[model samples]
Target chain A: MEIISFASAVAGLGILGIIFGTGLAYASVKFAVEEDPKKIEIDEALPGANCGACGFAGCSSYAEAVAKGEEGIDSCPVGGEELIEKIADIMGVAASSSDEKKTAKVLCQGGNQETFNKAEYQGVPSCQAASMVDNFKSCQYGCLGFGDCAAVCDFDAIVMNDNGLPEIDPDKCAECGVCVTECPRSLIEIVSSNEDVITNCKSALKGKEVKVVCEKGCFGCTICAKKCPVDAIEMEDNLPVVDTEGCIGCGVCVKNCPTDAFVEVDF
Target chain B: MQELFLLFMAASITNNFVLMQFLGICPFLGVSKEVPTAFSMGLATTFVMVTSAVVTWLVETVILVPLGIEYLQYIAFILVISSFVQLTELFVKKVSPPLYKALGIFLPLITTNCAILGLALLISMEGYGFIQSAVFGLGAGVGFTIAIVLMAGIRERLEFADVPKPLKGAPITLLVAGIMALAFTGLAM
Candidate 1:
């Protein structure tokens, strides 16, 4: 009885398998969708970061969009120049000339010793939550040292230094702009990696007002603006904005700043 | 007609495959993160369930019973359901790429869902007629959809809520699902 039942089971399952297998084979041919072959190639070329830096959900979807000619070859910011060139080659399109690489620069130099707090913020350690209360710190426009930007960075490029300030490593940075958006004080900016002259402060408060709270705060002294020989520095709202096009990487502004707010970044 | 209505009510509400019987809990938690995606997943599962029900019923009554191979029901049902899911996936992909993308991995996952197999076995055990079995499958699928979509809605709101640190992610989600199961028990009455 056992052997007969086993044989019948095997026969029943075999017949079922053959029927379903043929059905699936017929369905596959009948339901075949025409997919672009270039999509797979472009997907392979992508970095697969799924960083959403290009406003797409993931690398595969971005590849599909690019393959469909909906998005340009330069849409991916994390892939950099080499990936773009490879994708262009796959698509048989001329790659655009490489743009200057940009990296995140921390504008605030106010570390633990340089800045003072008004009251202890014992709530959630988020910068957004801390910024909502006016009494968290004395300087309203400086780094909160809460590491909000560092938390949002997927590249592991931003780290809180020993002094409780985020220091971005340019080499590790992808310039995806997540850190830039996460900063409540807007103290992180994406700047040309090759540009040596950078204002290390983002404060627009006058010199006297800044000196009361943070020692490292930009006093908006206008010394850098006055000393610029090419008139590259313009004072707007008590802050010196440097025009990269006009500035020739001269150290005049760096030496002339009263508060040493102008910093010279190497590489 | 009355019997069919009762069967639908029993399968959908009084004895929901997800909330009541606790079948297919994987997709219940996994795909219930978003409403639109949850709805799509539910729809895909529904399509598979209904089709698998009809196909498996025909196989059991016509081939398995006559050949006295009733012991092979489990393997035969799995084989029928999985292939049905595969065929449905290909058809949905070709017809609507957006829906196919929305369904994503959950479409293929319907093959392994115990709810489909359970429905088939329950119908055969209960000796439901052809139309009655089809209705039961449809009702069970609808029950799964309602449960998942409601769970998704609750979870979407939970995102903005200031939930406590200890009960933040999955713990809170499971707690919410338990509460929803409690609430669904009211439907039984």
Candidate 2:
């Protein structure tokens, strides 16, 4: 009886396996979807970061778009230049060197020391949370210093400095613009690395209010705008907007600004 | 009729597969990110659970008990459950392309989901008849759907919430799951 039971168990299981195996094999062939071979290849070739930096859901969706010729090969910023070349080679197209390497610029210089607090914000230690609850920072338009931008940066390129402002490492920044969207005050901007000048402040307050708020606030004294030899600086809403096309990188604005709101880009 | 109704309610709510029993947690957490996706996963799992329950019940009664090899129940149940999952995947892919895309890799993952196996084992362990096993499986699946859908709704809201930095992603999700489990205890009369 024991031997018969053992044989029955083995035979029963073995029969079941064969039945399931055949059933699955038949179903797979019967229900096969016609997938694009090139899409699979492109998916393998592309960096599978799925960061949504390319405006797609993930690497697979992006690959499908590229395979269908719906998206350009240069759309992926996280992959950088090498991925572009690889994709171009797969697609049988000449790789366009269209992307200029960019870096994130923190437009606010009003760190913890530079600005006074209107209230002691004891809420959640996130920029979004701080900004929503009356923004304790004296400058309403400055970095909240809670490192919301730093938190979203997938590349680990952003760090909160001693003064509670984000310091971006240019070398590691992929310019994916995730940090740009993360900032509650929209203080972070992606700019061409080769740009010679950047405004270190985003304060829109008038000269008097600016003085009351932050030492580093752009008081709109119009010194840099007046000093611009090529009329590259325009005063808009009590802030100096630098026009890169007409600006000569002479560092005149950097030198002339009393509050030192404009600084020459180091890199 | 009353007994069947009670059995269904107990399986779906009081003895909920995901919340109360804590089976099939992988998909419960992984697929509960969005409402639509979570609903789809729940439905797919429900279909598999019901079918596997009936099939495994037949296997236990007709084959294992007759052969006096009830110890082979585990392997036999696993084989039956995995095959049904594969068959379901094929049917879903052929019938609805959008759902197939939405489910993505999760469709195949149901093969390993312990909830279906647990239902099969529970049915046989309780010596339930074929009709009773089927009803129990359906109830268990409905229970899973409710738990996952609830989790997804809360997670969607949590996206905009000011969750603390340390408890942002997985930690907060686990905390929410724990809280949900505690809340479900209220239904356990």
Candidate 3:
């Protein structure tokens, strides 16, 4: 009798479990979302770094975009060329390789030795906070003599030289733009490192107007503007804008600039 | 409805899984330092918990009991949880790409998250019916979310304040968690 009772108990549990299991399986399948298998394939083809370097949230999102035809495959900066090829092959499309590999270079030459600091800042010495609020230093456009750029760099390409200015290592640069995004002064720019030379100074005020507040100020002095033989350099609001298309990497502007603001990053 | 309220009360304050029981502490600590990240992790964990509870209840009721393979529950539960999360991830990625983006990697990582496992175990151990299990899972997830998010907001503010050397980093955070647990313990009465 006890054996029969035990068997019945087991059977009771079994039937209850079976009923619940079937119900659950039904709900799971019923509520189950329809997902594209192609997105998974594309995601697998991606580098899976989750770096968010491609302006999307993550690699999976990028894959979904590729599947829906919303995004091109080459936008991933960290994925490089090989991953691009993998993605193209997965999609059964011919790989488009027109996007040139571009590198980032700092346009300005304003190191600590180049620009004079008004006073030694005691508090948070980060460039972002310094740019946001004036410190003991008098100038507003000053690099704040802080090394926030050096701090956030993932590749260790940027280091604070003894002069209290960030110097970029030519070989170590991955062109990740952490520094460009980190800088509070908007001092960092993603210029084409390979194309040609660039003007670093962002000062718009003319020579006399700029010189009073800053010693390193590039006064609307059009020295580079007058010297460019190809008319590639244009002087706007005391700043020199180079038309990168026509300017043929001529050494004329670098030599002519009296403040020496226009210099090569040696990319 | 009453069952859901009871589960909510239990998960949100009284039985409080994260602050009280200490399941799923890895993400609670790692991701809780930032508000946005902690919030997203909480939501993703909740979604996984609710779904897993429903599925595990079914697997136990239907597959194992009838066949008398009751001993295989542990491994079977784990297998079902992982595969379910993976299938859900793929499905969500295809249909709602935006949700997958917003949730980030936590969408897939929650498969191994112990909180989901614990919720499944808790419901089974308590011998909860289907409705009771769902409510309990929902409550537990809410509890976890509340704990992590509150910690995140406090940590963000704490970043500006000057903290002592020994109490800096993990130490201070843990101390804060203790205080939070103490505070939530008051909810029991």
Model 2 ranges off by over 4 Å: A1-7, A34-101, A108-166, A179-188, A196-264, B66-68, B101-106, B155-189
State the lDDT of candidate 3 residue by residue for A24-98, as single tens digits.
576567656556788888888777654444534456667888988788878777778998888888876664354
The TM-score of candidate 1's chain A against the true chain A comes to: 0.70
The local distance difference test score of each candidate is: 0.82, 0.84, 0.73
Residue B180, candidate 3: alpha-carbon lDDT:
96
TM-score, per-candidate, Cα-based: 0.68, 0.65, 0.58
Docking class of 1: acceptable
Worst 10 residues of 3 chain A by lDDT: A95-104
List runs of model 1 lying over 4 Å from the truth. A1-10, A35-103, A109-174, A181-186, A202-258, B98-106, B186-189
Worst 10 residues of 1 chain A by lDDT: A49-58
For each model in turn, which proportion of the native inter-chain contacts is also found? Answer: 0.43, 0.41, 0.00
Identify the leading candidate in terms of TM-score: 1
Worst 10-residue stretch by lDDT in candidate 2 chain B? B102-111
| TM (chain A) per model | 0.70, 0.69, 0.61
The positional error of residue B71 in candidate 2, measured at the CA in angstroms, is 2.7
Query: RMSD in angstroms, candidate 3?
Result: 8.0
